[model samples]
Target: MLKLSEIQRPIERELTIFEDKFKESMRSSVPLLDRITHYIVKRKGKQMRPMFVFFSAGSCGEINDATHRGAALVELLHTATLVHDDVVDNANVRRGFFSVNALWKNKVAVLVGDFLLAKGMQLSLANDDFGMLKIVSDAVQQIIEGELLQLEKARRMDIDESIYFEVIRQKTASLIASCCACGAASTGADDATVEQMRQFGEKVGMAFQIKDDLFDFGIDDVGKPLGNDIKEKKLTLPLIHALKQVGKPEKQRIINLVKNHNDDSQKVTEVIAFVKANGGMEYASSQMLAYQQEAFNILTHLPDNAYRHGLEQLVRYTTERNK
Candidate 1:
């Protein structure tokens, strides 16, 4: 697999410029808000979302000011969601660093998230980037709906393959879809081309999520603790497939363990073992690969360029990454 750095060579300079612009976008008049936003920027992730935006823009037309604004808008909304998610999950850590909620408390974290969201909208509106704003705004709505749908289904523990797909499509895929759509739209691509990039991004996101699901069953020392999903009583693709393969009694027993004994290490280990024994990991892997292939197929129809190739490598990276 090509390293992300190598894949990034095509738009390396653009990404560098985007960094400064994104930081400027996060600036606030309040001193405390500035401190918190700086912390968020310093511990930023791999810049995967911006890479998607730049790549899609380059492939469709040209990397321009609108593309930069679009990438910044996506990052603002994405970071806001992550901050809110940590508060909702009551998670103290993110990417091995203390989360905003951990250092600043829930009330502060929530306000910070709101501030980031408002800043994103303001930036777009100031520049008349309504197209990009609508794209990201729609994604935000989908993510909220997805989280709510998951919570509703989680209570009943009744997520089937279809429901699972729907949840991920809305929660995870929608954001990536917007990244690609915004990228293309920023480059002044027509509706059809933008839609094509959105479809491609959605497929990659699907594969990316399935890969994350597989990590829970993996024996390797992935950053997150093993069986974290089982502990949280979240039924992912592997557990869902495993449940479908078993007899009613066995299925109920496993579900009971997940629902009640999820905190028990031994029981969680047993559930992981059951998922592996029933070919859950294999089924999920196959499904992930299928989505990856679908993403590649979409890329083939687009203009052949270094940027398109970069997008292909990014899809591979998401599925192939260890953590």
Candidate 2:
């Protein structure tokens, strides 16, 4: 496994350009919006999405202007979704800082999210990046549908493994798949290469989400509150697997606890213990590795280069990362 810094070294220059483009795209005439956007820029994450865009482009062909736009468009939509998610989750903290909704309240945050979304669309239209736009737009729609589906399942507490996969695929994997496909398309890669990268990204995204699901049960501080998913009634892979192994009565008891006492510290601890005891962690970990391997297999088809190596390291990192 390679360190993230080492993996990113291959595309550091491209990422720098992406950072500037991203910042410029977020600029607004409105003083408050500008301030909020600047705040967001200052506290941005590892730029993993844009890194994926650049690496995917480099793997298939040369990076070009369209690749930059693809990276910007993905980041714009991703940030907008995060803003809306904060409002929906009533989350005060994001990336260890106060979320936009926490600072400016729901009304401003909602508007800001809308503004970001429109800016992403405008970028695509202005550049006539319709191919990238279509990919991103489809991803956004799937993400919306995934969230709604998850919300519905969360309320019912009836999620199965298949449903869990579907939720994560739409909610998380679709965006990542679009990132790779857009990157490939931007470089004028053939349809076959674009599809291959899309598949690879989807597998990696699955592994990424599983790693995130594992964090809910981890002891280490993962930047967010532990058991946040459980509290939110989101049954992930581990818990879902554990449910399948239990007797009907035991499963019902677990479900009832999740429904009625999820917030209680003792109950959450008990649920976590039950999940671990039932081999939930092992099962989920194995599944995550399976997806990682699948992604690696797909990557083997692409022409090998430093970018491909970086992407391979990224797939490994997705499962191995503590956070």
Candidate 3:
């Protein structure tokens, strides 16, 4: 697999410029807000979403000011969601550091999330980037719906393969889809091209999420402990598929462990073994690869260039990452 640094070569300069602009966009008059936003800027992730935005824009047409704003808009929305999500999940850590809610409080974190969301909307509106804003806004709506849907289904522990896909599609894939669509729209691409890139991003996001699901079964040394999802009563792809393949009594027993004994290490291990015994890992891996191939196929129709090549490598990175 190509290192992210190597894959980033094409958009190195653009990313630097975006980093500065994104920081400036987070600035606020209030000292407390500034401090919180500064913390957020410092603990940023691998810049994957911005990379998607830049690469998609570069592939479609010239990278312009609109593209930069679009990238910032997406980043702002993503950061806001992460902040709110930490609050909802009652999580104290993120990316190995104390989350905003941990350092401050849930109230502060929620307000900060709202501020970032407003900033994103204002940035787009001030610059007349309505199309790009709409793309990301729609994604935000889908993300919320997905979360609510998951919560509802999780309480019953009744998610099937189809519901699982719908949850992931809205929860995880929609944001990346917005990234690609916003990127293309920023470059003045027509609706059809924008839609094409959106589908490409959705496919990659699907594969990316399945890979994450696999990590819960100890498929790789992903640094995190195993069965975190099971503990949360989150029925992921591998477990869902495995449940379908088992007899009713066996399925009920496993579900009981997940629902009532999830905190027990031995029971969690037993569930993981059951999933593996049922070929759940293999089934999920094949599904992930299928989505990856679909993403690559979408890229084939775009103009062959460094940007497109970078997007291809990025897709591979997401699906193949070790940690």
The CA lDDT at 226 in model 2 is 72
Per-candidate count of clashing residue pairs (backbone under 3 Å): 0, 0, 0
Q: Candidate 3: lDDT of 153? A: 99
Q: Give all candidates' CA lDDT scores.
A: 0.95, 0.92, 0.96
Pick out the ten consecutive residues of candidate 2 with the lowest summed lDDT. Answer: 219-228
Full candidate order by lDDT, most accurate first = 3, 1, 2
Candidate 3, 318: how far from true, in Å?
1.1
lDDT of 1: 0.95
Stretches of model 3 off by over 4 angstroms after superposition:
219-225
Better of 2 and 3 by TM-score: 3
Over 1-323, each residue of candidate 1 has an lDDT whose tens digit, in order, gives 77888989999999999999999999999999999999999999999999999999998999999999999999999999999999999999999999999999999999999999999999999999999999999999999999999999999999999999999999999999999999999999999999999999999999999999899886655443499899999999999999999899999999999999999988998999999999999999999999999999989988888998899889989999987
Error of 1 at 76 (Å): 0.3
TM-score to native of every candidate shown: 0.98, 0.97, 0.98
Model 3, 83-200: lDDT tens per residue? Answer: 9999999999999999999999999999999999999999999999999988999999999999999999999999999999999999999999999999999999999999999999
